[model samples]
Target: MSHSKSFSLQKIINYIGGTLIFFGVTYFVYSNWLSLNDFFKIFSTLGVALAAYIVGALLYLNKEYDEVGSVFLMIAGLILPVGIFIAFKLTELITGINNLSVVSFSISLVAFLLIFFYFGRIILLLFTIIFASLLFFAVMELITTKLNYFFDDLIAYQLVVLGSSYILLGYYFDLIKKYNLTGSLYFFGVLFILSGSYFLSGILSFDSTLWKMIVGVIILLSFILSVPLQSKSFLYFGAIFLVLFLVDLSRRLTPFFGEAGWPLILISLGFLFILMGSLIFHMQKKIKK
Candidate 1:
């Protein structure tokens, strides 16, 4: 077979094998869901996770079957959260404290963190951090609402905190030479922070100039970050958001300019952007040469 054909066939076989194994496991456990107690369900799944991790670790350490070992360990990581979720819910049920999802997700985050500690897998760490922060904030909101301590801007502020923390954490990882941690963290980091900041601006009812300044600052920061991270997503999002801010600013200020200067400002901003792009291109060319 051709190389491309062989590669494709290998992928197909892997997918089929994975699906069959998963389906078999699911089929066995699912029918017993109603029949089994929480303890039984939790322990059985954890037993499988433990077995997979031990065998996978031994194989990985031997270095002869690294790929198989990695696959098995990843499988164990994937299975762990299900077991944790059940255990957390069981705890809450016994204690009569509600917010089961939040508690379960929090425990699941810890499970992923433990796996990351053992394996040092970047994706695992990133997802764990992301979900942990989100679940923490969500639980806080839930509790505050239950206790009648909720405020109108509380969750928005929490979102902002979450976003800023992600970005800072990404930078911290980068400084420590953890390169694998950057891409996903930065991508979602920008998403959450920017959206949160935008919402905050609306809630705060900032002046048009202040809004422009905020967007401009982030756009510049993203551009600066893109150079080091080599991430086009950051640049693209920055450019997109800058344009959106400009358009929104123009729309809001149109009445003050009696509609004539509104279009004029748009045209002016367009020319300014084009000029900036040309300058950046020339500067890059000069640096490269």
Candidate 2:
């Protein structure tokens, strides 16, 4: 019991200490911002990030201190992007690039990915994903703005594509037994797909029948895939989106159906829900087995 307590306590101290160091440096820089030259400002952040990363890498070699090392690594990851941004701004590179955010995120993504490959660390991979996502958005924004090709639903289409890509990546991670990373990918993937489809459905305006049909198909696919994938994330997100779709469909049908058809629709939907519940329960049981 004492040993377990001490272990937890040590972890808390390590985390707190790492956090304090990061904040202390940030505060010091912020406080001295007026007095510092551009060179000092840019290098301060980069230098600190490098120092933290090196310390973390060295500490990672000792098994007992590996977790503490991860805290420092995370600190480095968090600060590195800020440092990159400062460097880009100070160097006046933004004027040369069509999209500074895209360039910076690209650089950050590659750096983090290289570090992740060298260290085999999940936290670094998380940073890589974050920067990659930023790069995607930055590029999307640039394309839409520069080309003037952005329709009302362009973002929706982009999200659907991005979500599908995330799901495929999650599947690849699953193949390699990277379950921790897989859950996040699955979660964000489903979230983006459903949210995008929801927007495309024109729930408020009933603007697109084709998109509504597509949304229904996606919901069905989620439920169907959930059983095979053993993903409760898929099941629950599907159920929620299904309810939203039904609600919107019902609202749209109100004028056509009149008052008499309302009760019938409600009864039919209630039965459908019961059936869905039964299926979900059985599917979950099967997955557990």
Candidate 3:
């Protein structure tokens, strides 16, 4: 077979093999789950991970099949989180501390980050960052619940901070010579920030003026960042959200002007676009001159 065909065939084989392994292990575990003790149950899960990691380590250390070994190691890393989660549950059951599982998960996140960094995989690092952030939110909610800090809008504010952190980390990665990942990080960052902003805007919708201003600012900032980053993800998202924001603003103002206000805003926006375009054109021409 040709090289491309060979790769495709190998991929197919790998997928099929993986599916079989998954089903076989799942069936065996479920069928035997009733008879297994707690210790056995916990260790079995962790043992698979440990075994995978050890074999993968051996393969890579020998350098005979480095890429395949790396794949196995990656698989082990994926399963490590599951084992950690299970360990967390066991700890919770034993300690009887309602939210102490967060500590277990925190440890897992730290260990995974260290292990992935040692392995030197940017994609894995990205996955870990995204996963750890989700767990971070989970921990936040748990702590808040224990502390009785329930507020309807608290989650949005936290999300805004989290989104800002992602943006900062994206820039940090860019500084370290990982340019390709900045787009992914920034895209997710924008998504989270915009989401939080939307929620906050909804909560503040009683003030119609503020709603329009908030959404307009989001659109402007998202598009502005896109210009410097040259990221299509931000450009497209900003455009889509701008339309949604305008529609929402129109809907919120329907009590004041019925449907007429929508048309007026649309027309004004059109003229504003024209004016901005002309100014930009003139500026570019002047700069070139």
Q: How high is each candidate's TM-score? A: 0.69, 0.85, 0.74
Cα deviation in Å at residue 169, candidate 2?
A: 1.4
Best by lDDT: 2
Worst lDDT 10-window in candidate 3: 280-289
Q: Can you list the residue pairs that collide in candidate 3?
A: none
Write out the backbone clash pairs for model 1: none
Mark the regions of model 3 whose C-alpha exceeds 4 Å error after superposition. 1-35, 58-66, 91-100, 203-212, 258-289
Better of 1 and 2 by lDDT: 2
After superposition, candidate 1 runs with Cα above 4 Å error: 1-59, 87-98, 152-155, 203-213, 228-231, 259-262, 276-289
Residue 88 of candidate 1: its Cα lDDT? 61
Q: Which residue pairs show backbone clashes in model 2?
A: none
Clashes of 1: 0
Residue-wise C-alpha lDDT for candidate 2, range 1-289, written one tens digit per residue = 6998988898888889888988988998899999999989987897788788888888888887888888988888778877877778878877534366777788778877887887787878888888887788878888878987868887888789888888998989988886378777888898899989889878665788888888899999988888777678788899888888887887677777777678877887899889888878887775533
Which of 2 and 3 is ahead in TM-score? 2
Q: Write the per-residue lDDT of candidate 3 for residues 108-222, one digit (tens) a residue.
A: 5665577666665554476578567867776777878878888887788778788888888887887887635777788888888888877777743544466457767887887
Among all windows of 10 consecutive residues in model 1, the one with the lowest summed lDDT is: 280-289
